[model samples]
Target: MEEFFKKYKIELEKEELEKFEKFLEIFKQKNSQINLSAIRDDNGIIEKHFVDSVMLNIFLDFLEIENPKVADLGTGGGFPLIPLAIVNPEVNFVGIDSVGKKLKAIDEFVEELELKNVKTLNGRAEEIGQNL
Candidate 1:
């Protein structure tokens, strides 16, 4: 778990980390309610979803982002966005999704975890990205 902590240490507070633990539990419970996640089991969620999402940090420095305004287009199930927010609080993050159910799920997750630096928008990326 040290590696996990090291990876996410910049963003997650002790309380947020604790909340993440609880969020996982709640996600598991609520996931059944909404089918928000494909990875049903805990190991799958941890390995495939969580770890995989956290790994995006490897690209930021390589991509030479001092600070960037990132948009996670079509961020269904909050994949790279949620975990990315947990790993790099300094980076400005926005998650855009067209699915209302998915956005609701993400809103609950964001609220429960109290992730301050992340925001979600319900719209098509093409429509909004053009405006930006």
Candidate 2:
């Protein structure tokens, strides 16, 4: 992944990389117990889930807002938001999923990752939007 990130000119700090590595381990372990994602392989997870999520950094970097907020609709297994939150600690992320079990897993991941900027909502977009 170091070479992969370097190839793409993605700048990830050592600590961030370490956190991602830890996240990978945790993700794989949990995935085996319960189907986390259709893309199960490590390379697939890294590319599709982790890197794909981090790619949003390019847009987030352009945000002029002081406290940027993002919502990942139908977030299955916490994908972009989890990786995004890990990298962008200053930005707040909301992951909305209809599945309570998936959200529970996300909560566990957030606690294990010691993340302060990530929150999960277990509801469909329509229901959540109506409330807001």
Q: How far in Å is the alpha carbon of 22 misplaced in model 1?
A: 2.5
Candidate 1: list runs displaced more than 4 Å.
1-19
Residue 106 shift from truth in candidate 2, angstroms: 1.0
Off by over 4 Å in 2: none
What residue pairs clash in candidate 1, if any at all?
Answer: none
Task: Give per-residue lDDT, candidate 1, residue 116.
Answer: 83
User: What lDDT, from 0 to 1, does candidate 1 have?
Assistant: 0.78
Tens-place lDDT per residue, model 1, 1-132, is 334545655444675466557667877887899887889987677667777777787787578777787789999888888878876778889999999898888888888877887899999999888887
Give each model's whole-structure lDDT: 0.78, 0.87
TM-score of 1: 0.83
Clashes of each: 0, 0
Q: Tell me model 2's lDDT, rounded to 2 decimals.
A: 0.87
TM-score of each predicted structure versus truth: 0.83, 0.94
